[model samples]
Target: MLGIDCPKPKGRWPTAPFDPRFPKQNQTRNCYQNLLDYRPCVKRMRRRGKSTQPCEYYFRVFHALCPMSWVQRWTEIKDGTFAGKI
Candidate 1:
C-alpha cells in the first residue's frame, strides 16, 4: 500500500504514481513498508479467494523496487537480534 496502489494488475506490469500525499515509493522506507503491507494481502487474498492464477502486483513491485538478495538480508536484519540496531 504505502501510498501507492496498483492498477487492477492486468498481466504484463503494474504502474502507480508516487503519491504526493506521502513519501515516494522510490525511497527505501516506503518500498519496505509496501512489502510489509503486502504481508497481510497474501492472507486476505486467500480468504477472499486467491489470485494465484497470475503474479500479483505486490510481488511485481517488490522485485521492481528492490533486489531479491536484499530481501533475504532484510529478513535477517528484521530478526530480533538486529531489531532497532540498524
Candidate 2:
C-alpha cells in the first residue's frame, strides 16, 4: 500500500456551504450566480468605503465551484463581454 501507512494531514479544506437558493445537485447555476454576486458585492462595498471582507464569502464559493478555465475566461472578458450585471 503505497503511502497508506503515512498519517493523513490534519486540516480540512474550505468549500462552499449549502445554499438554500441552489438546492439542486447540479451546481452550475450556483457557481455562476456566486461569481456574479461577488463582483457587485465588492464594488458596492468599495463605493461605500466599507470593508470588502464579507464579499470573500462569495469569492470563495465561486472559486470552489467554478472551473479555473471558466474563471480565467470570464476575468478576461468581463470588462465588456460578460452579460451578468456586476
Candidates' C-alpha lDDT: 0.52, 0.75
lDDT of 1 by residue, 1-86 (tens): 22223335355655444645346545566556556656457556656787733335555665566666975565554334433321
Cα-lDDT of candidate 2: 0.75
Worst 10 residues of 1 by lDDT: 77-86
Residues 41-83, model 2: lDDT tens digits: 8778878999877887787788789998987667766364677
Give the poorly placed runs of model 1, Cα more than 4 Å off. Answer: 1-16, 21-26, 52-55, 73-86
Top candidate (TM-score)? 2
How does candidate 2 fare on TM-score?
0.79
Model 1: colliding residue pairs:
none
